[model samples]
Target chain A: MRPIRAKLTQLMIFGVLLSMLAGCSYLNPKPLKPWDRDVLARPEMQLDADSMEDLMDTKIYFSKEASRGGANIGGGGCGCN
Target chain B: MQLKQTGRLGPALAAATCTLLSGQGAQAAETEQVDVTSLQYREVDRVNVDEEVIALKRKGKDEKRFSLKLYHDTITGASPNGAYFPSDTYTSPSGSSYSSTLAPITDERYAVSADWEREDSRRQKTQYGLAYSIELDYDSLGANWSRSRDSQNRMRTYSYGYGFNYDVIHAEGGNPVGLAPATDTTRSNQDNKLLFDFLGGVSQVLNRQGVFQLNYGLSLSNGYLSDPYKFISIDNDAVVDNLLYEKRPDTRLGHSLYARVIYNIDDNVLKGSYRYYIDDWGILSHTLDMRYRYKLNNDFYLQPHFRHYSQRAADFYSIVFYDAPAASTYEYASADYRLGNLDSLTLGLQAGTRIGKRTDLSLRYEILRQTDRLGEFPSLNASILQLSFRYTAK
Candidate 1:
């Protein structure tokens, strides 16, 4: 019973998030200007600008615990095995 | 006089030699960069790991690029045995016993991987990669490919990525049973596990200050998915011994939906992400991670990050083996705390600075705490520290 409820809740949240992502343009439809990209182009502004760091962080977390793949591609293996 | 000049130049020559040996003086074409990172991770009184990684990336004509990575890490100390008993020690059926804390273990891992990517003039990009990692008893080989396309106006981007991993697990010496009787010395066979991950995402440039992406992924793992070293304790009258090997469904299907947005406001960049994950093993998890990078001038930045994670236990997870006489007869059970209900919080800070025209350096520290432990296990706290440097040309 609890598992079912949890799955349902997760599904609902996923649907809501998907819808929100789809409807974002409706809320703010302004197109970015060329000059606005100056800040956006900064290395720190990109979510995965440091791909190596992000991958290592994910790998560490994956080995130390369970649950996987929240970010990019999934890797493999267990350290404790 | 020449000898005196040579002596005077010794310090300069030594400095030059040191710089060259550090790989900082290597010359590259306008389209290459090298990144080096070192990480130290410690789980208070549990495990310690030291890792070193070096990556080289080069760009070619027409936006084509290739990258290679060399990684190695040494891990030492004890890992949880998944056995719990009120007594100080609990013995398993294989004549092996462990304390309430953890089991002693050590392993070394190494991996080498390469990636190639290219983007055409039409804004269509493709990336492919292969990686292999080997440890003492386990080996994994993985391949991944992704393709993305930008909309006509380049305002929206769509991507699809597929990854597959093949792994072999061979226990050192021989595999032992979870709940073997005193007389049983059955050696288990090698186990194989295969995993496939599929991901699709749509990323949109929401104004110049922000970009948002929503990704949905599915992961399917088949074959021997349970930890061979984990055990379940059956404290029932029907079982003479309390230790039993854990058994899990051979197949697991997991789904994850993740959303992320990065917005740059003034000198600060704000990043936020949320993930909802569910699996057939009756585990559901939610993760929220956020970071803020505040630039203090044009050359340095400080980033503070916060992450929260929560998950429910697997259906067969239990601290103690308390099933019916017939069911307790080793159908399926696990005492691994990783599969139990838990919540964790991570707080981190990173500081980085640009040096010279093409060199960058950064240091990061994070502390993590896992609360709401399952069973009688103590809470977990860990810390990680990392330092990284990058040299870019062009």
Candidate 2:
């Protein structure tokens, strides 16, 4: 029952985001300039894209687990977590 | 005591996890004009008893690249037996037994990939590359291409990618379990092997408060997907023929979804991620991870990360011997943890800073422990310490 709820919560949030993405437009942000690089250049601000710290945690998490790389695990095995 | 201890780790863990995931109590760095690149090298010596591995990556600038990886899952060597633990022994905590033997491995991986990228502008970029690897008689060659477009000040982005891997598997070894003699070099039979992955996703700044990204991927594989080298234990019974072993599923179609969200408060950053996966091979998995990164000062910061992951083993998973006649010809061990309901708790710390005027370095230590969490469970513990250094020409 708990897992079912968690799964449902995931689906709901994901669904809402999908709809917004589809209907998105540049004006979502107020009066923008043509050459604005603030949003695009904010590397520290990236959501899914991993930063150095994120990658390190990911590698450790990945190394320690029995599962495949999740997205890709074609590489060799390492005893290191 | 055992039940009380395990139960205690639950809610406190969940609350802490939620706090981290929701991205609170952390500060975000104010941007400064600076360029950064990072590199890592790891040589694991646990060999056969473990698989040895080495990797290097450099990302930043206008181009990003990384390389090399090896997985000797079916590694040949002697194991503590006490570690990977065979089935049964739940009658009591100390009921299990162990022995040492010169064992052979069934799973192996040797792969490498190099990719290059080019930016058409701040809003558009393209990437393409090729990679190849071989395990046992199985070899794979593949290529991928991706395109990303930005909007809303790059606060939001969309990307799509597709790739294909053609694999070739050949049977080897005289041992039915797929182990070769200390001196046998015979290369045996061949079978069709192939896998495919397709991905699409979007990333967005949810608010001044945080950012979120989601991806949906499809994978199709036709060929040998079984673990010829893995084994399962039957219910507490050390029986005849040591319980027959089966191969992994042949054709598996799978889908994966994952997301990452980050929140900032002045000098602290909170990051979170969740992943959901399902495959036609009768496997489903879920993962949740979170971290709090705080800048202690200009040249240093302290970041502590915690993660929780859980998965349901493939339908064929077994705790041990099943009613033989009911098992499928392609049966695999319920003990094949790679296919079981697994939950992992990770605790980590990352600390580092800029050296002189043009050098940067950081150190990281992460610890992870896995639990079967099935009706009965087994544990495999692992840890890592990473030191990374980067310098750009002054």
Candidate 3:
């Protein structure tokens, strides 16, 4: 029963991802021209503008919790846990 | 007249905007940056940590960049030893009995990482990184490589990466054999493990006001997965009768899916992300995080952040075993509270302002609380404070 549920959950996640990908084209029929990207070019719009903060948070949580990953990879493991 | 040259000015303006949007203008010059960050973490009556990190980055002409980071931290505290509460005498399998109590621990860790990246004319970027960390009893070395490609319109990006880590652990005193009597210490003091991680991700610009990202990660680890210092007690009518060292399966496989969305409205930004994680050890988790940046003025802003995380227990997690299962029969078990069902939440606020044309400074504070679902372990509370400074030279 657990295996089945796990598989279903994986499928659901993949389904959501695929649907979101498909919706992307529908949401923006035409990609914004270069002149129209002023808002997107803002410093706050960068995905990892707070890289240092995210790094600290990830390390703290990884040491205290059982679940990890999904932000970025390759930081390495520690014995703090 | 200047006003009559509108036709020529229009094309020139379009070209300049294109250069900026494509990131070509920023790479036209070389720049160096330095960042320093300090963090303090405290858990109520438990562990406390002070950490500092410094990073140096240089972006050269031709879209090449190099970065180096140095990290140092000190941890001191008392941690649960996985025994039942009330400190009762427990008999060992070898006909000896002893009482158990929490132990105080102190340690310091130092780590360093370096990374290099280069982007080509085709809008493809490749990155390579190496990292090493050392503690009093543990050491780790890791390396990774990743590549990302952007669509011609510069509105979409696809990325993939692979990472490898090797770790060595040397427990203080001596490592206890799994499921052996707590008094018996005949096991090897050193053990090692290896980890491999793979990730694939995509980022899309939904519109001028929003962007979205999705990532999937898989991790595989093997060898010596159990904590060497923890043990579980056998309960005889809720009183401790015997103690045995904890044991766990030597291999683990984990999967995670994450999605994030960022939107801007009137110069204020809102960001939210969700993550789902599952592992072969019967642990499942969900995480939700949100942050909103409110622009107070052109140079100062305040942001509030919230994160919630919940996880199911591992299959073999138990607080106390009524009857201790034999090693041959059970194969794996642990009493670590981290492997138990639990929920955690974090609330934080951050304020930042530009100190000068080339300097930025930010401060943040957060509080976190964790609750055990089975009500066996005590609730954990912690607070975090961080300050960051950055300077850029062009």
Candidate 4:
């Protein structure tokens, strides 16, 4: 039963991802031009502008909690866990 | 005189023009940056940590970048040893009385990592990284590789990555036998574990004011999953009868789905993210985070952040065993509160400003609280303070 549920969840996740990709054609009819990217280029708009702070937060949370990973990949290991 | 002027002047003019153009290109594409950060974390009547980090990055004109980071931290104080108190005192089977209390500990850690990335003219980027960390009784080495490509219009990005880690644990004193009594003398000096991680993601630019990303991550770990220093108490008629070292399954598999959105409204930026995590150990969790960067001016901003997390207990997690199982049965059990049902919340604020033409500084503070759903374990409160400085070379 657990294996079946796990498989179903995996399928659902992939299904959602596929639908999102397919819907992109209709959702993004007018893509922004290079000249219109001024706001997007700002430091505040970057996904990981403050890498150090993000690293610290990830480490701290990982030590105190059981659930980890999602934001990025591969940050070695620690005994604190 | 005219011949000499044409011969020398023409070549010199062309050469100077070429040098000027190349210099301008180099200036536009090359960058060097250094960042320093310090953090202090304190848990109410529990652990305290002091950490410092330094990072250096260099980007070349050929779209290649390299970065190195150094980390050091010191941890000290006492933490709950996974024993629960059902009464003021409990008599052991030998007619001895004892009281449960926190366990004192101190440790220091150092870690370093280096990463390199290269991007081609076709908008395909590849990255490689290596990391190592060491402590008094633990050591870890890791490596990772990733690649990403952008769509023709640069409106979408697809990425995938893989990582591997090898770790060795040499517990202080010795590694305790799993599920054995705390007083048992049998022990091993070392144990090891391995981890593998895989990630896939997509990022989309939704118009000029917003962006969205979705990611999926899978992780697998095997061997030595138990904490040697933690133990569980067996309750017998409201008295602590026995204490056994914690035990856990040797393997774990986890999956996570994460989504994030960033939008710019006027001059302010708003960021939000959600994550759903599940594991084979019967633990399921959800996390939600939100941040709003209110721009007071171009040089200064105040950001408020909030995060909430909730999780269900693992299958083998228990506060105390009413009926102790035989050690020969090889049953899996642990009293670690981190594996128990709980909810946590963090509230934080950050203030950042430009200190000089090529430098910036930021300060952040956060408060976190964790509540145990079973109420058998004590609640936890912690505070975090961090300061950072960044300098860019012109």
Candidate with best lDDT: 4
Residue A11 displacement in candidate 4 (angstroms): 5.1
What is the alpha-carbon lDDT of model 4 when measured against the actual structure? 0.83
TM-scores of the models, in the given order?
Answer: 0.86, 0.68, 0.88, 0.89
Q: How high is the DockQ of candidate 4?
A: 0.66
**TM-score of candidate 3 on Cα atoms, chains taken together:** 0.88
Better of 1 and 4 by DockQ: 4
Ranking by TM-score: 4, 3, 1, 2
Worst 10 residues of 1 chain B by lDDT: B1-10
Q: Is candidate 2 or candidate 3 better by lDDT?
A: 3
Model 1: pairs clashing at backbone N, Cα or C within 3 Å: B178-B245, B179-B245
Top candidate (DockQ):
4
Candidate 1 regions exceeding 4 Å error are: A2-21, A24-28, A33-35, A74-81, B1-30, B87-101, B176-183, B237-241, B326-330, B373-375
Alpha-carbon lDDT, every model: 0.74, 0.52, 0.82, 0.83
Across B326-366, the per-residue lDDT of candidate 2 in tens digits comes to 43333444345556667877777878786776566666676
Interface RMSD score of each model: 2.3, 5.8, 1.5, 1.3
**Deviation from native of the Cα of residue B2 in model 3, angstroms:** 58
CAPRI band for model 1: acceptable
- Candidate 4 wrongly placed segments (more than 4 Å): A1-8, A11-29, B1-29, B88-100, B324-330
For residues A1-81, could you state the per-residue lDDT of candidate 1 as single tens digits? 867776786767677766866575564456666676777787777767757668667877666556788577844454442
